[model samples]
Target: MLLVLSEQEKTSFTFLTSLPEQVYPDLVKTALSQLLSTKQITKVVNSAAAKLKVEVASLTNSSLYVLSQCLLNSAKRNLTPEDLTSSLKACGVEVTIVTPLVISYTENRDILIDIITRSTVQAPEYRSMEWRLECQVGSRSLHNTVIPNVLTKWKISDPRFNNLKTKETYLNCDVNTLQHITESLRAAQLELDTLHARKMCRNLARIG
Candidate 1:
């Protein structure tokens, strides 16, 4: 069945869906559960070598995955699923999700370690720092960061984030509530990015 959603809803859905279940299988379920503590989301814990490697580097490696929705809807870009997906891989971010999607995390001993061993980062800092998102979707280690400010801005809630609702409102977030927070974040961030881009354009125009 087709589901109707706000631009943000769709954006968050696509991003969370593409991520590895190991990190946030119960993303929807857990988002409902106090929005996944920011503390848990930011640091990797009790993970094997592979899971540890991937989650640590999610931001730089998977900008497209994280930004695909915003780029498509807010920036009015015509990025295809393949395009964004490929861009993510090319950037060295890992992505995986099993069928019959889970709302909570499960054991994933089978999660490939090939990506972790074979992946190459261009810089020392990128090599050491991790890239895990709250949801543990596609992740990567960046050789050189091109967008630090924008990257920080992209990360809204938590690494364990399948949803972005504040916790005071509910014990765990439901799909309905998840959708609400996603839209709110998207609207605010898209506008911020648009303005940031516009100012850069104006500055360039003046320089020329």
Candidate 2:
């Protein structure tokens, strides 16, 4: 899979989002990282953001572009943001940005050098019934980007090896778009303590 949100894209997206310039990069980077955790790879993989590694054509000119060629090339590789985020978590990546649940994949692999969303898996929350908050998120985006060069890594054909629904319960959005959470894991807004994005950018200029 190819990811578009570059280290620089994070910078630009931050500008667009109109978030504090100082803190925007962190937020954008965090948003991009989510894709790595909480996304699915179609027929080959299940919707469990357990682990994700993406490839990109290049990160040039303070801009970023990504091209994700589908591995399975499933006839219907339509994935939701929730599906992607959950899968990323199952592997190890954490997603916490405003989840953009919809992404498109190609049947054939190609080099995509365009801006792409950085997927993320949200920190787990408690169901409204159980009601807990141990899973509160810290970073703006779920991805860390501490490890670069996400491509060149091989993935399992199917993580499940076999698709089995141990607990059978129809999802709220199996057909239409819907993001559901078990009554046990509902949440209020996450409280993030951080610096401002705009200020940080200015600081970089001062140092440079």
Candidate 3:
């Protein structure tokens, strides 16, 4: 008989199939829960590390595993993952995660430490600073910014402002909600990247 699996079921089965089964249900459940959390940490670490623009492929898995534990610890301490340099030191990752070549690529632990520092997004200081948005249509330009705790009707400097449009920028959302919005943006970017890759593959096949 053939087995049918949904995408989620396939993913779960692939992960679990490699592990040894235990007789105790509670132990299995706890292990699976930790595994899921670790997976999430790996995802966050990898995305954050990409901001460093380094060839980190060699230490990718090891670095993610070590960094994920620090991330979890940061949550317990109510600290930002942006405290990455200290967290890496606390985790003793500097000694284990890097080789001579990895060190040379990053030029030292200070640069490697930047992987987390650059990746983690801190709460926006909208009160002290506003984010700018600029647009141009046929040489007509428009510019505006979102200010914190301000609900004033902001007008663009250029006449083209009326023609240009943008999705609702969640200026009113709390910092936590803003972080969720960033995560959603990352997911959307990944989806677009996958779509573009598939389109390129199809075009290449046609050209061949």
Per residue, candidate 2 scores C-alpha lDDT tens digits across 56-144 of 21221121221122111111233334444454344333232223212322211121212221122223332222111122234567654
Measured over all alpha carbons after superposition, the RMSD of each candidate to the real structure, in angstroms, is: 25.6, 24.7, 20.6
Cα-based lDDT for every prediction:
0.35, 0.28, 0.37
Over 1-208, each residue of candidate 3 has an lDDT whose tens digit, in order, gives 1112234433433333232333122222222234343343444334434544433452243333323333333333344323434443343333332122122323333433454445555432222224443323233353463333322223333222332432223244444565687899999778767978789877664322
Best first by lDDT, ranked: 3, 1, 2
- Over 4 Å off, model 1: 1-21, 28-75, 97-199, 202-208
Top candidate on TM-score is 1
Off by over 4 Å in 3: 1-170, 195-208
Best by lDDT: 3
Candidate 1 per-residue lDDT over residues 23-97, each given as its tens digit: 543332322222223344332222322443545344322422333222222112233444444544443333553
TM-score quality measure for candidate 2 = 0.18
List TM-scores for all candidates, in order.
Answer: 0.20, 0.18, 0.18
- Tell me how many residue pairs clash in candidate 1: 21
Clashes of 2: 54
